[model samples]
Target: MPSTHNPGSSSPLTSFGRSIWSRREPFHSIEADHESSEQELELQSFQKLVVDLFHDLSAVSADELLSIAWIRKLLDVFVSCLDEFRVLLLKNKAQVSKPPLDHWADEYLDRSLKALDICNATRDGIEKIRTWHKHLEIVMCALESRKRAFSEGQFRRARKALMDLTLEMLDERDSGSVFSHRNWSFGRNNPRKDARRRQHSSGNSSGHSRSHSWSISNSWSAAKQLQSIANNLIAPRGNEIVATNGLAGSVYTMSSVLTFVLSALVAAIPCQDRALSTHFSIPQQYSWEEQKVEVEQELQELASICENFKNGLDPLERQIRQVFRRIMNCRTEGLEILSRANNLE
Candidate 1:
């Protein structure tokens, strides 16, 4: 179909031309590919600018969106951490591989908390949040350092997380009256609790545990319910949130048990000597050799129980370890992929 246009003649134009030039084409023909390429380049530039803006924000965002942006910076910081962790791990790889656990604990416990902040920031599905979470944890462990528990920088990193989390949670609540109220104070690691719990000697332990397992289980069961709801806020395999909350709940439950145990001990302290003397007749009735044998047997039993829980917790340990491993892998792989992809980009 050949239609010819003379220099002074006009042809009916398309809707596009009408909008652009009121029924007239600006040029007789246009090169679409070149224009489209320019547009794509411009879009790419905008995206890059946004990413750079986020990078600039990392420095200032610590006071505001600490967790989310901090996670973003971790892409680099964690690389530094991994190098340190690898060096420490090499020295202790065969000697002691326990450093991996601290890294695992950080993500499995601490990192999940960071995920909560990100989840709030993004308000995305559990799976998406969880994917982000698992990746970060795995990567962080690669950075695990054996240098005095943690490097000063790592300590600050964790401290920032704690402070941010505390402020976020407390900012929502009023602690009621000052005279009789519970105040929350978070610090790096469970340092204070660990120190206080260590102060109590094994010899001081009460032989009486809670008489009923039902009551102990009930407390954990209630905690699990609340934890599940909170954790579900994360997307797709985002269940790490649930597991972290579970661990925190367990820590809280342990605290409750410790409180109960301490109250019992304080109440029994005055009568402890009398009770022991009444039952065993002390040095007169039992020889040092017999006492040693009894203590060693108790120690053996305790060791067996610890081993049982470590090696065979029915299903709970397996469930926990599975999530722990996912989080660890995700963090490591995510960063590795990012570095490579960024290079390509």
Candidate 2:
């Protein structure tokens, strides 16, 4: 049952081999070219996206800067960038788990986790504003300046509400307490249910699971949290870009964006332990850096505006109502974004 081949004789097998050899092309080179092409496309797309985002953000006027509406837009930009970055990771998952990239992904994820605390703190700040808003409502209702003449009792009620609001704000400032000790978060149905869920899911090993009902201690500092996020963040080198097919750059971009957005947020919102000094010096230059100075300017303006608002009761109700709406919208959007982040694998 054995077949033998003659050394000097050409058989049908020899002819078939020649035909197959003739049809063979440089498949390895072709595949390499295709992959290279795809990588370039992905890199350029991400870069363009980042550029566009910053450009749009920087285009805001000075009056709008640090306003509630502007901050809401900033959150929208962040969520969009986050979604795109997630897609990039999914597309290159094979390479994502490999050397260098895996390390970067882990670092980015840790930063994201830290960001969750800031988001929760900011929401608490919003809640505090909401409480302030209620007092403002009381003042507005008591005055009814537009509808009727003011009475002594009405004046007394409005003065009481103003006194209460001032005391509440001052108390928070004196205590440096940004978040309340009651332990709350966005997107939760019930705090008791959340506690039960945490207890039940205790055995699960997922890191993101703990973020659902995250709470901050009384001594927690927003400044320290921001410093922790900005710490050890470095831009990838040119060699790293080549090795990881430019994913390193995207990671750096996302990290920087996250840091900038958070820094600006802490600067604008009323968080506890308000040390508004976070150094953000990346090797690469970004357009968003200019916004830092703008944020600082806004902080100064806020202090002066508060004094002015205290003196002038005519526009106080309108201003408070507008800010309340803006913060509510931002809080709602933030909950949705954080929910998506928690679900990311």
lDDT winner: 2
Root-mean-square deviation of every model: 29.9, 21.8
| Deviation from truth (RMSD, Å), model 2 | 21.8
Worst 10 residues of 1 by lDDT: 269-278
> lDDT of each structure?
0.28, 0.57
lDDT of 1 by residue, 101-134 (tens): 2233223333332322221112111112233233
Off by over 4 Å in 2: 1-36, 147-151, 178-215, 275-345
C-alpha lDDT (0 to 100) for residue 173 of candidate 2: 76
lDDT of 1 at 181: 23
- What tens digits encode model 2's per-residue C-alpha lDDT throughout 217-276? 777788998999899887676667667777777777777777877776776667777632
Steric collisions counted per model: 16, 0
lDDT of 1: 0.28
Alpha-carbon runs more than 4 Å astray in model 1: 1-64, 67-70, 97-345
